[model samples]
Target: MKLSPSVSIEQSETGLEFINVASAKCDAKIFLQGGQITEFIPKNNKPLIWVSKNETFQEGVSIRGGIPICWPWFGNHQNPNWPAHGFARTSLWQADEVHENDEQITISLKLPMKQVNTTYWPHQSALKVEFILTDTLQVRLTTTNLSNAAFSYTQALHTYFPTSDIKNTTVDGLQGAQYIEFGEGPFTQSEHVSFERETDMVYTQAAVQQHIHTPDGIINVSRENSSSCVLWNPWIEKSKRLSNFADDEYLGMVCLEAANVLEDKVTLEPKQSHTLITTISWA
Candidate 1:
């Protein structure tokens, strides 16, 4: 495969496959296992995505940060033993296409449906993820139902963003949206969102865009075909329970996910398709 200066196939110490990119404007690292992006840095700005310092690049295991693809299901599954965020993040993906210009590189990967576990899925489906790494980062996840019956699922681009100080950071553009935290009631967001303690909230009727104000600068996050979003910071306890995360690591990162979950779950009829898109940029 002839790739640009910004793109190449690399492997982790444990033999995990990844696409490494370094362009004139930015740099990134993407894993082929889940079509997951583990790093994105635009020019002189700080890292827009964050990975756990304690993370071990192992096979069939989801990495702790960057943007993890949560597909088919968003959270804890009905069957508790099943994977929390579906199997996509742990499954291998086939790189199907690659396109590059002078300033940007785009790579596409497709899920191997024949090898997928049919136990959870309904209706024949097709899954694809694409990453466009330029000065900014853009991701697109597409799903198509090829069967005669309709099917539904929840999904998200579980994006982890870095912060100089988590407590001082605030997220904007979510005023008036309703959210639920820890299975609580539908509360409304009256102001820009900020974190203090352990925080996990899912917002409904969300706007198409939001902004994260960190000490360094503002990062813009925009989404398409998604009316729901999730915000999470372990703050303390849950961080200890996570496999690759440190107990105090929550203070350095925040998860502002672009999601289609709960009331926003997507249902597709025969031959129908849906695409969820998210873009991130920092100046």
Candidate 2:
């Protein structure tokens, strides 16, 4: 990939390669290992993405924050031994293009199918992720079916956002959506969601836009081609068992993922394509 005035490729101390963007509008980093972005801070504003202080930047290991790409399958497969959240987050990606304009810098990356193990994902398809960085951030994940047969898959843009205090944070706009918590109750949401304990809610029929009210400010989150999303916080005990995360780190972060799980999974015919998008900005 050619270097631009606002973008350049850099390697971490652990040998992982990533693209760094430092333009007038923002500063960000996108790792090529998982096609994952671990940082995004708009100029003159607080960070819009949160990464764990103890995250491991090793080969084949997913970094613990930012936007992790969960693909092909989510959470777990029919077989219990399969890797949770699929293998996309640990797969190496090829940087396809980088462009810069007056308003933003865009980076495009694609998964190298040959590097992928067939045992995990045996389909012939193309996966690409694009990052649009300005004062706001936008991510687009596009999957294209290249084989003659049709296939179905589940995925999510697992985004982690920061908060001064989790207890004071609330997520609005899920008032009428249906959600399942800890494999229980496909119940309806009646008010703004807040965090008081470990939360893992999978929602369906969610509104296209949601607002996260943190001690810092209100962050607007919007999604496209997605009706399912996830809200999670490890709270205390669960946070202790999580790798690459501090025991009390849960107090400073929360995840509002744009996902396609359960009934929202996608099925594509040969030559068809689907794009799942999410945009973040200040409300």
Candidate 3:
């Protein structure tokens, strides 16, 4: 694959090597230590895959369609159609900038103004995603509407986390939260968060961050300007159809989506921008 113009590489204090794909609009981790992926991110756009592997240092949390960023709409959490989880995750992005130092590297990608979005989303806007990494990881998404008419949309950062066993894992920070059980599609559940057969609940008005505790370590998810969280694990059946997911892979990962949904649709006036920042730090 061709590297973007703004790409750069550097060494970190921990002896970790960083590879920033500024042009391809993504990040790559070519080196790590102790057989662990020191950094977690995506690679080139063809497969639109995220994560990297250096021998046993695999950072990939395989969930098939990569980390789908549902935008404009986060599927019909109330209905059944709307294409699983919306479409922003599949769209190709253009690199805008890249910067690197001994400790970290940052890469920015944008969805430029185009004639295509007029059909469904009739607003002129740009979606920008920034990848900021040290030995740790953070991703920030900014949406700017340049059209005269104001527009509203729901957004999500669907993260697939790696684990030894989902049964052994638990997500903290969602205690005593209420959610909508998506079967009749939007049925509300005002109960404590716990394990179920096929967990598909949308936790509304969540705390700005949460933690996914695995046997290995804790993956902390912190957000800014977001109000909703979705904790998902497709279990056995759903993992079969997805090519990028190994059989029964659902046992090893859970999706903790930092989202804006339902009554919380974000609106951007002309020349205005809305930003969603997510930081994934491990310990």
Per TM-score, what order, best first? 2, 1, 3
Q: Which one is best on TM-score?
A: 2
Candidate 3 lDDT over residue span 1-283, tens digit each: 2343555555555444444343333345422111112235433212112231211222322124234566667766444643455545544445566666655667666655472345556777887777675545576778898888888888887766777777888877876555776644444444334454578778776778787777767777888888777888877777666655566667766778778876666978889998887777665
Q: lDDT by residue for model 1 over 1-283, one digit each (tens)? A: 4666668899999999898887887888889888899988888867889999999989888989989999999999999989999999888998787788886788888999987888877559999999988889999999999899998999999999999899899999999999999999799999999987888999999999999999878999999999999999998878889999988899899999999999899999999999999999995
CA-lDDT, candidates in order: 0.90, 0.94, 0.61
Clashing pairs in 1: none
Highest-lDDT candidate: 2
Query: Which stretches of candidate 1 lie above 4 Å from their native place?
Result: none
Better of 1 and 3 by TM-score: 1
User: What TM value does model 2 have?
Assistant: 0.99
lDDT against true structure, model 1 = 0.90
Model 3: colliding residue pairs: 4-23, 41-51, 42-50
In model 2, residue pairs whose N, Cα or C atoms come closer than 3 Å (at least 3 residues apart or on different chains), thus clashing, are none
